[model samples]
Target: MSDQLNTRQARRQAQKKKQNSNNKGKSKKQLIKKIAIATAIAIAVAIIATGITVFAIISNAPELDEEQLMLTQGALMYDQNDEFVSQLESSERRMNVSISDVPSVVQDAFIAVEDIRFRDHFGIDIRRLFGAVAANITDGFGAEGASTITQQLVKNLFLENDKLMSRKIQEQYLAIKLEQQYSKDQILEMYLNQIYLGSGVYGIELASQRYFNKTVEELSLADAALLAGIPRRPSFYDPTVNPEAAESRRNLVLSLMVQHGKITEEEAAEAEAISIEEQLDVTEREAYAYEAFYNLVLNELEEIDGITSSDIYNSGLKVYTTLDTDAQEHVETVLQTSEYIQNYPDNEDFQAAITLLDTETGQIKAVGSGREDSGQQRGFNYATEAKRQIGSTAKPLLDYGPAIEYLQWSTGHMITDEPHSYSDGTEINNFDGTFQGRMSMRRALAASRNVPAVKALQEVGTDRAKEFGEQLGMSIDTMHESYGLGAIPLSTKDLAGAYAAFGNNGTYTQPYSVRKVEFPDGRVLEFEPESQMAMSDYTAYMVTDMLKTAVTDGTGGTANISGLPMAGKTGTTNFDRDTREQYNIPANAAPDIWFAGYTTKYTAAVWTGFNQHSENNYFPSQDSSRQIAQQIFKAVVEEVSSTIETPDFTMPNSVVRVGVERSTGYYQVILRQVVRLFMNYLYVVMSRLEYQKNLSTLNLLAI
Candidate 1:
């Protein structure tokens, strides 16, 4: 009875233990089920969030202008004779070729260097992208580029060169779209065509021609490898300038080709041993030799409506300038063949500038800013930018013109040429030390008498003279009394325009360089000069008549062009204070000289001086600044006279010729001559008496 009772108890205890074990198993399974459900919900939420982000990025993408993708063409410049001058460089050199046309080695070499997985990826390579991100985080800067060829093409064509995250994302998106639109071969072709190689060379075709003097199909394995290396850093790897670096880069490309199974080990080794110098055939590119003229054309083209300077330099439009090729060539020849240029001073301080303008239309016919061969480190445009004192050239613009217009002074009107003091307490004297007392306006101006010019300015009032000068395009806005003596600074170009007004019947026309710009699509933008009446025809005629007298028989006699009816003025500034300060000199001497002259056909101005304002200590024998001007003027005028008949200056009805005796009208003229004659006779008699006394004294000594 006791055994049975014990057995029953043990069985009950076992059953209870079994039931507890089963309950624990069920609890473990339920816990695992809850955890799995929570994890699945979290994963679903994450996927939904990722989809939302991608959708937002795609929906808010910025719109791109398709026209911007079109390749930029360079502008062509032509002379007036329709001769090709130069091409204004704009975009890259490019020649599109199909994948079949490209050598297999060429395609393989570029693929190995630029992008190894170019064929397998769909625009963006996720594995390479993640790897690049990790490397960029670990390194100081991001040196690894995971961009595929498709990505690069899209970034170059459709996006700016910004390295921000947003730009990268846009680039990726556009690259994916481009990949869908175009085949892999097509993208590769575009990439090869659009990339910049070096030395202003763009595209593989141009690079092949420039470096190897061969086409893409003619390239060897070594040649292909070398060209593939240049697009990475053109300047640093340029075969001509840096052959060692270029060779190193080429060897690296060959090694990459070997690693990528594109080229065998033996082939890579052989190509690596090849010299880039042997393959290089760099030649000087054809360019325009006229620097100032090219610069002027570029400057003028910048002001057009649809064209910018970029268009002139890169868009490949044709620019037809107002430059007459014959005139330009003649002017350049005259300046280069001049005795002054042949024997130019060794000192950098000395420089010369000349500008010629057409009277019929204010076209800049020819410009010589500096020596054509001067390899000057500092670019000083003496014709347009450098301003120097014009001296007596101001006589016509500031003194005589204003005097005739406002004070009703005629060419023969009497004006005293004695020393004069202005209201500002400034005193001025004539060019020569001794003045002729009094002289007619024509003689004063022709002789370039400083005192007379100052007095004339006073008669017309300095304020009025300033206005009159400004109207004629002279930049004389100073209130100083010395302005009548050409103390104001002006450029040769500005002076040329101001002088052209006199020949153009008092009409001030703005000078222009480019006559017209034609677009690649045959659209034309023409340039018309702006003109305004600057002075009365009568006043201009009077001033011109006085200037003609100057060239004929006055201070400007050096500039007389025989058989050419011309009028001009000569200006010389004696010892500039600025020059003295610059050189720390004790005395002042004339440093700046100018000759401004005009005919009915053209007006020209020549400036000669030291760029550094050197002291006037040294003087050359054969080439004084004035003599140089005379040579230049004669040469250019003779060339122009060959083409056109020399026309006479038209006289206006308001100007009438009135003759006057040389020594009769003014108070000092007759009286000074008579007194001078009597004094001369008395001196002769006294000298004869003194001689007799000396002779008598000698005879007494001998006795």
Candidate 2:
């Protein structure tokens, strides 16, 4: 009876255990099903939310109006001869070629490099987009861009060049709309024309002409591939300026072309065999040349009545500049080869500037800041901006020109070159400290004597002198005696214009680079330079004649040409210790050198100095500045000699050449004191004796 009871209890327990195990299995299965349903519901919500967001994005995106997609056709600048000089700095510089004008090979080149599925895709490539997203997620940010040609066109035309996610999202929305609105060929044509290639060249047409000197329809396969690679990173892959980088880019394009079956492997190999240098027809970039001349043009344009820099840079207006491309190239070559520029120990720190202007029209022919890679920022051309103390180059504008004009002083007028103390207790000294005692105004100016210049400035009141300089286009800020010695600062352009007045027969026509502008709608605006008769023709001739002595036998003697009648002034501002200390700069920093002069056809200014303080700023000798200026002048004279004739200054009817005794002088009018007058006359006699002695010594040497 006990065993039967035990067996029954055990069986009951086993049954209960089996039932509990079955219930547990059923609950676990039900729980798994509920979890699965919840997960499915969450996934559905995510999909619906994503769909709603995309719908909202597309619905709210901007319309594809024709105006919304209007392209920026930047300004084109032409030289005087109507040949393309360069495309000015602009947001876009495109020459739109129709699909018919664009060759098949050119299209293929862009497609293979930029977007292989460009024709097949509606607008955006899903595979590429997802891959780019994956890459970004993996690598954090900006890991890749999978922009198709359509997307690029949208980004360039409709949006600012931003790389944010918002931009990308908007890019896709507009690209899809663009694909729907325009035909495939239309979209492709727009893409080809609206893209930015290197060196301010936009579109395939301009790019082809710029790189290979060919039209889009005439591009060879290699040329096409090379151009297509530039929009990737214009500056980094500039074919003309950065060839090694360009070659690598070109090869990648060629390889892509072969992989896409657009070109055969053998064909790509042949194209690759041709070196970048051999394939590229362009020898040098005209972009920097354009920047140099355009900076000057931009300044003048700002003064126009209805023009702004924005209008010139963004509008499709055509700018006709007075820039002589050949002359500009020549000047660049001369600067590169000149001794001061070439022999400078520190290549990066030393700076020089050159400005050439047409004397008759006041047209800027050429300009350079320093070397090609002087780290000069755009629009800050040192040629037009570096207003260094102009040194003795100011003597003619400040002292001689005014003295001859207002004071009725002749070149032969006697002057004392001894040190003088002004009423303000300021002492004036000659450059070398040893005075020549007395000299003719012509001799004093030729030698750039500080005392004589100050005396002349005093004779013509400083106020009047400043007025005269202003009329000639100089900015004379101070009326101090030191102003006579070029303590007043001025730019190379200002000095060149001032000197050009002498060559222009005393007419100061404001310097200009843009001669005319043609808007896209066929409206033409002409630029006429504002000019005035700043001085009499007689005075201009007299001053120019006196300046001739400088080139022939004075400080600028090295600047003389064998058969050219050129006149110029050499200005060397010796290092000012006090000024250096005041500025807390190096002792070698204060000195600035200049050569301002003009021929019958052209006037030029050349300046040499350290742009920034450097240990190598020490000039080789006292005459080193003048020697350097002469080298530059000779080079330029030789360059343009064949093109323009060096004519003599026209003698005006009002001027009369006369000889006078060294003692009977125009002295009392300048100095009120009789004793001072006698001393000045005595110095004149002493200078004449010294001049005669030098003349005799030269004659003996010749014998």
Candidate 3:
């Protein structure tokens, strides 16, 4: 009985041990499940944190305000009245042109060449991205840009100038947001206006106008296609300098358009049949075109707020300025086309410019920078930039005008025309250096006699000349000090304003380009020289009177207006005059001759020459400057004199008297006070005939 009981207990013990081993295996499996659940939770938390950071970055990208956007676009110049001038930058073809108003063909042409699926993609095209990546990896950078219209807009509006991955990231994020906020059409319009095509073209309309001289509406299928080809490589396909290459490129664009179904193969063939123009194949950009007035407004705008150049274009501020539109156009047309019959084709060297201003309001009416394709931005704006040696032109304000206004010097006041050494050792006279035995200020000025002017300056003192110029708004104390005899540099613009004091009855109206600057919202920030005055009324009248005698009988005789009371001066810079003679060639070249004159209707300044020197050995010297400048001035004046009524130039009292006697600083006569007034009719009216003095004393006094 005892042995049976022990076997039963042992079997039961074995069963219990097997049960414990199974439980251990199950517990281990349960532990592994808990660990996996914890791992997945940790990964989920990390992913959420990462997404939030990325979202924050996407939410806070840099962007441009309306004004800033427009500035980046670069379109701000306007007429005095705030009318549109030219669009400098931007892509929407946004030129105050509405999307619906634009021709469908233009729209299609751009879409075809740029991003085909632009209409469907929500700012980003995965397909294009992949293609761009493939191209970047296989080909080279810039070979393909995956920037959709919206992406490009974002890049232009929000991104910096650097092309980097950081900028690309920002662009992608902003592009998606832009697509959500703006319509495809709005984005497309902005894109067209903002992309830079070439030749300073900014918008589709301007691009059309520049490349075809035709309106966007007027652009043919072929023309539209050719223009579309420009955006990819503007400098490369520039039709102006490279034609055959541009043609090939344009044909490729056509092929792309056909492949993309934007145009039919038949249409592409027709476009291919179209001939490509080798030069300014579109329309020519007119030179100057009121550049002076435009610059004036620009400067003032820079100081003000709201009315930026881009705002001016899109906002269309009513810039009611002082410019006389007709006068501006007249001056510009005359200078550009009808004035000079010749020009230096493309100056491989040198540059030139011109500007004309309004005498009454100091408004710039016209300006020129030669040919549009000169690849120069009015570099050496002769009107304001060039510090050239102005010959007789400077003498008027420095020597003659000051003498009469400040020194009690009369136009009839006589001075010897014979050459003499100055304290500095410089000797000057007329161009020929021929001493007129005896003459009046009238004769001397009419002939541009240098010795008489130098003597007059000597009598007036160089300091006095400096003082006079400073009074007239010339920023030249140093120049004034060196005003000995055309030693100081002067610009056409400054000189014109100085002479204008006479036209304006002595009030020097400071010349300005911009009329007024208005914020984009139509609030004006600056109106240049609202109270600008360059000289006093008395001084202005005095100077104008002297200039009258100059144009009427002086060296500016070539500038006389038949039925008008006109006054002006001739400026011949010291360049190569005649290489054959010793000191024969003057200081500047001849092509820089000038005729700054004014009538009741228009005050114009003319400068002529091949703006650039040719590589073919033709140096555009002073001779070219004189013959062209004077003739152009004459032609322009003659045209106006025939049609426009002449206005009255304020007549100042007294006149320029010459030949009194420089030998003794007095007239050669019985009484020391008896001045042998050459051209004695000047003022023929100052009744103060003077005091008792011996002839010896008077001759000594006059000289």
- Per lDDT, the best of the predicted structures is 2
149: Cα error in model 1, Å: 22
Candidates 1 and 2: which is better by lDDT? 2
Deviation from native of the Cα of residue 362 in model 2, angstroms: 0.7
Stretches off by above 4 angstroms in model 1 are: 1-72, 81-83, 89-287, 304-306, 338-343, 346-348, 373-375, 378-380, 581-588, 615-625, 666-703
TM-score of 1: 0.58
Which pairs in model 2 have colliding backbones? none
Q: Write the per-residue lDDT of candidate 2 for residues 1-703, one digit (tens) a residue.
A: 9999999999999999999999999999999999999999999999999888777766765556575345565667888787887665434355778998888988898998888999899899998989999999998656898898898777655553446666677889898878988988998987777676765566788777777778888888889889888877665587755678898998999999998899999999999998986776642434544577875675566566555333454455688988888888787777666543344434465567788888888988888656655543223467886788888998998888888788677677778888686658788777666888867888998888888888888889889998998898776566777777887887788888989999888999877788898865467789877899999787788888888888887888877877777789998776676655555554333357788888889888988776665444545454344366666766776577766667788766566543332345432212224334443332121122223434443221100
- Candidate 2 ranges with C-alpha deviation above 4 Å: 1-70, 88-289, 338-342, 375-379, 579-590, 618-620, 623-626, 661-703
lDDT of 1 by residue, 1-703 (tens): 9999999999999999999999999999999999999999999998999778767766666543344333655567787666887664544345655677889899999999888888999999888898888887887334567788888777655554445556677778887887887789878887787666755566778778877888888999999999999876665676765678999999999999999999899999888777776767665444355656765676455445455333443346787876776777777676655442455555555667788888768888878776544433222357776788888998899888888777767676778877678877767766556788777788888888888888888889989998888887776546577878888889888888988888888889877778777765467778887799888787788788878889998977877888898999988776656656777654424666788999999888988766554444433322354466655665676677776897899876555443223334311112323444443211001112223433343222100
What clash count goes with each model? 10, 0, 80
Deviation in Å, model 1, residue 698 alpha carbon: 62
Query: What local distance difference test score does each model get?
Result: 0.72, 0.74, 0.60
Candidate structures ordered by lDDT, highest first: 2, 1, 3
